[model samples]
Target: MDNTKIAVIGAGKIGGAIAIALKNNNLKVKATCRTEKRLKELKSLGLD
Candidate 1:
């Protein structure tokens, strides 16, 4: 089982940064936002 778990809500400037940083370090992360645009942006940034 994957022990790394991180939930970063509101994928804005700061939130996106945190999510990406965690993912880059080999952790599981899920970033969400209130808009489709932001969600797409987060997906493009490599978040599932």
Candidate 2:
């Protein structure tokens, strides 16, 4: 089966947690944040 690709616009705690959980379920995650700091933190959490 083809996996789903998701784009999360916010990298806040809730959003990040959702993205991570989706990824763990085999979905591809693309997280977008308002600031470089948040983006870096998301990246560190393994979101692309």
Model 1 ranges off by over 4 Å: none
Q: Which residue segments of model 2 deviate by more than 4 Å?
A: none
Q: What tens-digit string does per-residue lDDT give for candidate 2 at 1-48?
A: 366799988868898889989888888899987888988988887889
Mind giving the per-residue lDDT tens digits that candidate 1 earns over 1-48? 368788998878899999999999988899888888889989998896
Instruction: Give the Å shift of residue 12 in candidate 1.
Output: 0.7
Relative to the true structure, candidate 1 has a C-alpha RMSD (angstroms) of 1.8
- Our model 2 lands, by Cα RMSD against the true structure, at 1.3
Model 1's alpha-carbon lDDT is: 0.88
Top-lDDT structure, candidate number: 1
Q: lDDT for every model?
A: 0.88, 0.86
Q: Where does the lowest 10-residue lDDT sum fall in candidate 1?
A: 1-10
